[model samples]
Target: MSSPEQTTAIVDAATDPARSPRSLREAWLALAGLSAVFLFEMLDNSILNVALPTIGRELHASTTALQWVTGAYAVVFGGLMLAFGAVADRFGRRRTMLIGLALLGVASLATAFVSTAEQLIAVRAATGVAAAMTTPGSMALAFRLFGADGLRVRAITLISTVGLVGLAIGPTAGGLVLAVAPWQVLLLVNVPVAVLAMIGIRFGIAADAADELHRDPVDVAGAVLGTAAIVLALVAPTLFVDAGTGSWVPWAVTAAAVPAAVLFVLRERSARHPLLDLRLVARPLVSSGLAFKAATGLATAGLGYLVTLQLQLDWGWSPALAAVGMLPQVVVLIAGGSLVSPFVERVGLERAAAISAAAVVGGLAVYSLLGRFGYVWVALALVLVAAGMRVVGVAAGTNVLRGLPKERTTIGAALVDTASEVTSGIGIAVTGTVLAALFTGDLAASHWTARQTAEFQQAATVAGLTLTVVAALLVGWGIIRGRSAPITADDSDSSAGRDDSPGAEADAPRAAQHAG
Candidate 1:
């Protein structure tokens, strides 16, 4: 659609009282459009991951290039999401979402035609930009469609469940596609899906432009600083894990991340319209809530890489069978999602987070003993872990929305997804590097089979133990912290920053019914 046509259609939808979802039929249709966007965007992360090995061989790419292909989208997405969310808030979410569909279509087409690894990586990055643009708008549109808390919660849960389903199915779907056709065809699938999604949005979703043309500055400096910091942090670990690479680059990037992070925080504090408020991190619930969500990413999308490598690289299963083997975990996620609301309502959000972490730790503990036990046993353990992760995700997401004001729904969605995406990248980097190191254990091949076997087991053990320690810390934090009130979104105000008045930050956004 042309820009004028899109604007006109969306504006007409917004103004047409008849188009609004006052009826149940219209509301369900609206949810379908928004949820479809969420599904396609997140599904990209793991779906492409499955194609990495195929891509490497076809393009004559190195291991590092494969890693870049997998990580580039997430790195860019994590870096840009907050800025895009804030943009959606300032502009119209409907308009932004339409643009996102267009970009996604273009990027997917480019990915299908890439001849080199570098081009594939760049095209993947473009898709990340598309995701950043669309996701906040997707969430905000849902929020606008349903004002009642009960209805909104249900809608968000359905959207999240679809996302979970996408993550669950991505590898399996990718494998299935590769079984019949080349990797390029797999990417080309997105083009048609994108078109269908745009049609859904055009007809079903109501337009919701910003009341004002402009409210706050876009904070370009903060976005740049934040992007630099995240990219450096992610790259450091990947380089460190490369067997022959020097420590200098990793250490240098790590060092640079500190200043960039510091500057990003400062920039947000001072900017007229900050991409995200730094003080939101200061809230105990917000911080812990964010962490809980990240853990979900670690267990779900991130762990998919580890499992894929193990299944395809180590066990030598065809991608098709490996994906089938993953079905148990998907079943667990679906079943587990139903349990989240009741569990959070019963135990409170903080305590539920700790419990979820414990499940992850326990699952990893089982995975650590994969050599001793079989893949079946490891799969069973992951089921428990996946269930727990779902609970943590659902609990944290509901609370985060409650804490954020209704007006800043786009920004809140951005922050929530950013935390998960960044940590997913971290989790993939940490675990994949460990596995890669093990896979490349000795230059002098002494019992090559024996050496690879030993290293593979060792890698699993190390990654499991590392995550265990992290989850255990979250357990402590969740248990000891005082009950935090759900925080609201902060407006463009230096006054709250200046006045050290008691509870000044607390007063910024209106608190809703706490899911806790």
Candidate 2:
């Protein structure tokens, strides 16, 4: 019994002549489901950011412990995404989605009730794993349902919109809840949302099997190595900082991670069944997409943290006010994502992505000098950065998904999500560490005397400027590289030509053919 929306969607998909009505319909449902699912994910992402101060006060946490509240979730979340991508391939997407949602809902409920920092981190980690499982599957389902050049643009737009909103709303929502309801309420909010999404999937979605489910063995080794490499990369800085190892720890982690990654790549290349098909991702479109996404994450995530600090510490705004000030960012994000999507599908992905990446670089550059200006100027700069970031982010995801064969959608999505998480975690740690260090130095420059307050303000401005420049450069590189790359797939073609025979994965060339 499909819902009326589903029925209408299927009918429209069938009769529309662009593609099957059923396909369009499923795309819409997946869009809605993914949007809802990402709301929870992003909610969790920013929720911890807002609650950190409160959690510290209540739990008497040290800085190391405080970091774990965030780090724990990230480590588990990112580590599990690739593994879950395989699970989605093995099981049906529908069942995986429902089960993942259920686990997330339960974890959220438990998170709200937990009392200690350890308890919160543990519960959040569990929730992160659940989210990892659900996120990649949502993407896989999107590809399966939408097909190439079908409803992908609209779906990505909707997902981007939801994610942006969730990111924006998290701080305010968490603050309001903390004001009236306790930290637990933040965790509990996922329950109702998950219940609704469960209902939606069960009734609205039909089960989908991966196209080559039986042909390939799961690449367990690659999965482990990939997850370890990413997680180690994210945690290395923190480990260096926490262990008081100065410079050696991060260098060591980097050294280890590089070889592990190389080994994983070699293993993936030769293995009969790689966890992810490396050859496909090695394509210009896919590689560029991953790089673009990572750059965008580094820029926005770092900048967002800096802005929050500026609002709260320097401007003396409350959490609620800071959150409200960021509302404009959310609007810009959705608008930017929505604005670029149709053009991406029409003009081709690489061109569209390149344009968006340029916008991001340009925006970050424009905003770079803003910290020394008045609040209004800074606010305007934020809007520019947000809009640009939204555009690039959506284009990157759409391009990567389009470049992959349908069966590799989950793996590709895992790469996308994992890169995003890993990059963001680095952004937060690096930006936060730099700002903290700068602030401390400024305080000392004042001789720990009467000049403390004014010096703090100066430090904040400097920190913002520093981050703006770094973000600008990262985005600039992506824009230039993205322009030279090929777009993902043929806009007019379905993947109907894809061979489903055994070893079909081996037969597929990457985007290079399209480039030529």
Candidate 3:
């Protein structure tokens, strides 16, 4: 009963000598390279955040212009990831990744010569383009490097841990570097990272085989429509945050996204060779994985934004103190990687995903209900959410790639990331809008009266609860959908001679069981 794709994946894993790495030690070089790519993605924006004010002063840039310096990167990166994922699958993952690393190095070096905010924005966008090209490939390449499910989970956990460490330290590291070097050094550091990534990947991983590469022509029309829909969706959240609910721009953008998405789905359904095969996505494992990832992203982003605001604005903590206060979450994130493999082994992948995702919901609920009482509640909330995020991040992504065919792994990775990115934006928007609606007066004011303080806490609670509700729904659906037969070598053996056609009606149910 196994689907053709699932059957092929098992056979390939069982038979392929090329993907021989069974443990992290066996593939350190290639993994190190992929980890570097992930580090850049997580660190770039975070490191730049600390230097934004300095850049504004040095360049005499307006507030709006300064925002674009960061925004441009996010917009371009989120917009192009899916398209580039498809491209890498067709052409070559290694080839595309090396080219992207080169572009990243060049773009990072350009920071030294950026004399204006506009120039900086352009450079950031270029890096974003580079990120789109390479980020998804990192996960895909890592997955492809290993044949066993356990090794895949461990490899992804290792890479994600490195990235999480970078994210945790970025702002503090940026601050330290700024004291001794120009702001440009923050970006210029990427040059070395990119160089190391190139060496590791080029020397460590093998080139793609002819059979692994896609043979069909790229779906240009689907690409265009998909990109447009994602771009508009990303832009709408920012508009809601910046322009407020009254602004017509965000509403207009949101409206435009619906039609673009519809058109893209329609085009894909009708296309000879779609950019993203909707049929694959319809598989329970893929859908469940995406939903779990989306839930984590939403809760993580929302909780972080809300907590930062409460720490600095409501409690009157210094920026340094607020950063230190967030250390619990950071510590748990970096340390929790060690727990993922054991937990998954003990409980199984689907159960681990469900439990961890529920933990995220639980953390949000804890904060919503008890965060107003004391700092202890806030720290607990952060720890719970961080722990859950760490596990689910690895588990959900592994589920997705495992559910996919080997040839389509890069796009599968891209879909996982896109789900996270889009939902993170929505998370921020939902919390921000709720805060805006319930709390009156200047949020950035230096001092707040007792009434303002009370209103802020109320707003935070309402916002947190709202986010928790939304996250719960996502997690609930994921758990329900994820409940299928676990994909295993045993199933593959029994179903090897059965109908392995893509058009088989029973394929989805059979494939769903295999994702675990």
Give the number of the best model, judged by TM-score: 3
| lDDT tens per residue, model 1, 38-117 | 78876876787788888889999998888888678767777787788878777767778889889999999887568999
Residue-level lDDT of model 2, residues 118-203, one tens digit each, is 88888878888888888777666655554344355556667767877787778777878888876667778788878877765665
TM-score of 1: 0.78
Candidate 1 local Cα displacement, residue 47, angstroms: 3.4
Which residue segments of model 3 deviate by more than 4 Å? Answer: 1-19, 484-516
Per-model CA lDDT versus the true structure = 0.67, 0.66, 0.85
Model 1 misplacement above 4 A: 1-26, 49-66, 111-113, 175-182, 209-214, 243-247, 298-325, 335-354, 369-371, 374-377, 432-459, 478-482, 485-516
lDDT winner between candidates 2 and 3: 3
| Models, CA RMSD each | 6.7, 6.6, 6.7
Each prediction's number of clashing residue pairs:
1, 4, 4
Error of 1 at 177 (Å): 3.8
Best by lDDT: 3
Candidate 2 off by > 4 Å? 1-30, 48-63, 112-115, 148-150, 210-214, 239-255, 311-321, 335-338, 342-347, 428-516
